[model samples]
Target: MNTYSDLRLNLFCQSLLQSVGMNKENSLVVADSLIKANLEGVDSHGISRLPIYAKRFGDNRINIKPNIQMTKKSSSVLMVDGDNGLGHVVSYQAILNGIEMAKQNGVTAIAVKNSNHFGTASYFCQLACEQNLACIVLTNSPPGIAPWGGKDAFFGTNPIAFGFPTGNDQPVIIDLSTSVVARGKIILAAKQGNHIPDGWALDRDGHPTNDAEEALKGSLLPLGGAKGSALALAVEILTGLLTGAAFGPNVKNIYDNEESGKANVGHFFILMDIEKFMNLNTFFESIINLLNEMKEVPKIPGIDEIRYPGERRKRDKERRLQEGIQLPPSVEEELIKLAGQYNVEFPIPIPPLKANSIVSN
Candidate 1:
């Protein structure tokens, strides 16, 4: 189960969700959203999160049949309430609404309250680029990162994602957590017994700690020291505060606590029609030409070929589609249990784990 070809993985996801009583249509959408993270090399937010979803569902903490409602809707701006539905499904619907608004008004801003973690922010922003639009998205999570010089966490480890259309190439999409390390990274380290590099987080005493367990109990560091903390504060206003959703420590540990309340996580989506700013083709062509020239700069020894922010993930997605995806053993085991509970057949492995029995990353 750790390794599965693209088609096989898709089928497995469908079967697993189906066993949980999700209809085939809903299962496929959820599966695609989760597996797309694996294909993009963001395993931290990939199918490994299935256990979390299962726990929530078992506890009745999530309304499997969410009543998605629009709190406010307009030509250029909108607001929604997720009613604690699955994050990916809610996010997809909201973002699609924003995309349509952009078509009419040349730009749109959509915010949603009372949602759960929606995996990667990039997943939503990239949609705009596919439609020849520029996108800027932000999401607010449970507070796990602290502002500089602060002992307690104040702002969510907010992420800012941007996707710009490019000429004859994948869109230039930049998605990053504002913290020195995203909580997902901490989860990854804990799973793999990997020690984090310096500056990622601190223990409860405000002291730096490489221990993944300690970091999880403590707080993540902010990016750029104070500057990133400031930006995170701004993001809180745009996404959480603006939407009247959970803001700081109140939104803690939605992943592990079955008794916990709905996360009430919030997200903001902004899309600008390319034609509103400039000729879409010209804008993209100029950027591509600039990058082409920049790459020709005299090489420095030891540096790998310079690539844009989204290049590596794009390449990985393409490679993995044919070769298959690899998950950690523990993650694989977790997935299998879900498959068994669902009474779904397991899929065949392709490019399975190496002989070492560890993720061959």
Candidate 2:
């Protein structure tokens, strides 16, 4: 496979992301985060979503340069108005603000309203660890998952993420959707012209289906059976319900169509000062110990060695930076269109798979 260069890919991605509606700086941040997911083999959040975001943004559904200013601020809490801005851009700055606030207080809790979809939650949570803070992200998206035993969809993908700092061991960042698969999965399947495995989702009639188009018309199964459903609702309450944005059945996508008209999605971010809880160095050591213990465990019958939550991503980032990123045929086509729309020229496409870099999950 031919190697792709990160410089070219990043430039291409950023240009398109910005042309759609994101401010140049925010678009670059979004592009970098999306590319990080791709490098880590999480293609669903990568460039594939660009075209949809562009369409939504161009239509004035998602804001380009959101003022993300705080509406309420306290010693350890903040309330923000996203002003219908880009979720990624708003949430990224929100997390950074939370970290800074935590420095003055023992912890900081920030709730946001009027935001759109932010990519992987891990990206924002990891930002806290980069600055020696404990980070947690609560985000609610359009309803797509069913409450256990109930037929109708009642929960957003409703994701929660956690990040902790560590000394020698890598920072622990666990980002997950309460559903078996995120709603983004369906969007991605649509992009690749692929059909998902059955049992991943159910139709509007509550019957299992594999068609991405049909699943988009239906509800997704909760992860871990019922427990994930419970968590999904809890996250929705924090992110959407309480934040005054649409929640559960009311939330709609600003990305897809007129379907989710005027989406004002809400998100919550929290950052805890590690030093306030314990010595920063000591906290790192404890985290490192925990991760080290997990690493020593023998692989299960069919499992490989136990890896830390963000370890693979960190390694992938290092390798991909050297080897470059890849663009699939569909994504490449969209990027070409983006180039035309922005009146920009990009280098010839390169194959995604390469020597040091495996395609991101």
Candidate 3:
């Protein structure tokens, strides 16, 4: 394992994306999103996924130069065609369009089609929240979870994220996948040659399995069985069906190079100006008071604390910003491989570990 300051990791990600022919602005968006995931302790959506991204880029599955175009469907609705571009670039642009539209129209709904796998859904929602808006973000990916009472994979770990301001620089964020866990965690476990805990997924034969590789070949378990499946279906409908992108089994697997053209993933974003309902200050103050009330609640014995959805993430971000990110040995090796493949130097040089070092692994 190795450690790197956020700045160094950000630079490495940016340079790697640029090497794959992404424009500077697009690369920065991707880099920041990935690093933000790492900083917020969502390693499943962080730089660990970059190796696969590089592979897709090398295979020419991702458009080197995307011309993202948006069409207005109504006063408050927009549709974006990603042109097979990186999902981060496409989604960022779509959110930017939504934010601007929301500023004028109180609320905006943006649907994106023909995109690749974007990093974290919260990253986009949080972006809207940072602009003093309330946001809901949804995305669909390659099929990973099976339908209820079925063995075939049909739904991606379709995630939904919600974010809103709380009178602070950091907004309260809630992000969850319909699946028990994001598929990326399974992929990461497989890359590290580790087995997952039981009940997380079923094997190719539909039997419960702890092997990450088998889980990848099989299907992930839904978060709450049938109920989770239903939520996943809702996300699939909004992000894929409604957006006119490939849904269910029609979406190509990101790891399967033989599947054909682009991944054709889809994302849906809803941004609303906070001032639409009430004054921003009043809304934020209400949120803060509620949070405080929750924190002051009586606790069950043996529990240290009860934190909000975004509290831990905010703490993680601050600590990581000061202490840097730690990458597992397997992930570091993958990064090295990508650096060699792209003929780009790894941005951060590892330093000898010290007791008082800011970054170490």
How do the residues 226-259 of candidate 2 rate in per-residue lDDT, one tens digit apiece?
Answer: 9999999889889886777888878776655557
* Best candidate (score: TM-score): 3
In terms of lDDT, the best-performing candidate is: 3
lDDT of 3 at 323: 70
lDDT against the true structure, each candidate: 0.80, 0.79, 0.89
Candidates sorted on lDDT, descending:
3, 1, 2
Off by over 4 Å in 1: 351-361
Scored against the true structure, residue 109 in model 1 reaches a CA lDDT of 86
The count of backbone overlaps in candidate 2 is 3
Better of 1 and 3 by lDDT: 3
Candidates ranked, most accurate by TM-score first: 3, 1, 2
Runs of candidate 3 with Cα error greater than 4 angstroms are 349-356, 359-361
Query: Residue 235 of model 2: what lDDT?
Result: 93
Worst 10 residues of 1 by lDDT: 352-361
TM-score for candidate 1: 0.92
How do the predictions measure up, each by TM-score? 0.92, 0.92, 0.96
Candidate 3: residue pairs that collide: none
Where does candidate 3 have its weakest 10-residue lDDT segment?
352-361
Winner on TM-score (1 vs 2): 1
